[model samples]
Target: MLWVKSLHIIFVVAWFAGLFYLPRIFVNLAMETEAASRQRLLLMARKLFRFMTLLAVPAIVFGLWLFLGYGIGKGPGQGWMHAKLALVLVLIGYHHGCGVLLRKFERGVNTRSHVFYRWFNELPVLVLAAVVILVVVKPF
Candidate 1:
């Protein structure tokens, strides 16, 4: 169980790194007026998205294992885990949203301003803060 938890933390960090950086790529993609830079950023975004998604699967699987196998939140005192899971679900949606944006950027059809993407990039930071607090503080 300890090993599984350790791996879960590793993959979660990996996945969050991708999420954090990918939007910055989008910020560059949205700002780059040169075709060469656009192509390079597009390629980078695609590969990062793929690799991060791979990390996400195992992170989620291990989380589910912790929940089901260890019964971390099934009892009366661990309501924080439920909120943490809800936040994780929201993060998954955010991840999927990034994929949609990635496709839009790939096709050269992205309409959002680089400023918009700069703002968008802050979102995961907030989520990460909330999740870490919920888990570490276990505040309900």
Candidate 2:
């Protein structure tokens, strides 16, 4: 269980790192006027998204193992766990949203501004903060 927890943390951290950077790349992509630079940023976004998705899989798997196998959050007074799970779902949606945005950029159809991506990049930071607080403080 401890090992699983460690792996979960590791993968989650790795995934979040990608989540954090990908949008910044998007910010660059949105602002970049040069074709070569745009292509490079697109390639970076593609690779990062793929790697992040790989990390997310084991992170989710170990998280489920903790929830179901180890019973990390069961029964009464576990509202924090439920909240955390909801936020996790939101994070998943945000991850998918990133992919959607990436595809838009790839298609040369991205209409959003760098400022928009600047704001978009902040979502994961806020989610990560809330999740850490939920896990560590268990604030229900």
Candidate 3:
């Protein structure tokens, strides 16, 4: 059980690392001027996004396992846990949104800009803060 929890934490941290870095990649990619440079940036962003998605699956599954196995629901009203869960879902939505936007980029749509990427980069940090607070403090 402790091992599972540790694995879950490790994978979650990896996933968050990817989440935080992916948007920074987007920001850099958005700033590239030359066509070849932009294409290279796009390829890097695509690969990073794909890796994040791959990491996300096990993170989510292990998180669920921890929640159920640890009997979080058996404790006092888990308002903080609920909040964290909601925020996580929002983060998942953001992940999928990035995927969609990346597909558009691959299709030569050019929808996102540096400003957009900068703003998007902040979201994971906020979500990660919220989740860490909720998990660590569990304040009602």
> How well is each residue in 26-136 modelled by candidate 3, as lDDT tens digits?
787777778898788788888888898988898888878878878763467788877888998998999998888778777777667889989988998988888888888
| Candidate 1 lDDT tens digits, 36-129 | 9889999999999999999999999999998899987788888889889999999999999999999998887899999999999998899899
Rank by TM-score, descending? 2, 1, 3
Candidate 1, after superposition: displacement of residue 110 in Å? 0.7
Candidate No. with top lDDT: 2
Candidate 2 backbone clash number: 0
| Displacement of the residue 59 alpha carbon in candidate 1, Å | 0.4
Which tens-of-lDDT digit does each residue in 20-95 have in candidate 2?
9999999999999999999999999999999999999999999999999999988899999999999999999999
Which candidate model has the greater TM-score, 1 or 3?
1
Q: State the displacement of the C-alpha of residue 135, model 1, in Å, after optimal TM-score superposition.
A: 0.9
RMSD of candidate 3 to true structure, Å: 1.4
Prediction 2 TM-score vs. true: 0.99
User: How many clashes in each structure?
Assistant: 0, 0, 0
| Candidate 3's TM-score | 0.92
Q: Evaluate all candidate structures by whole-model CA lDDT and list the values in order.
A: 0.93, 0.96, 0.83
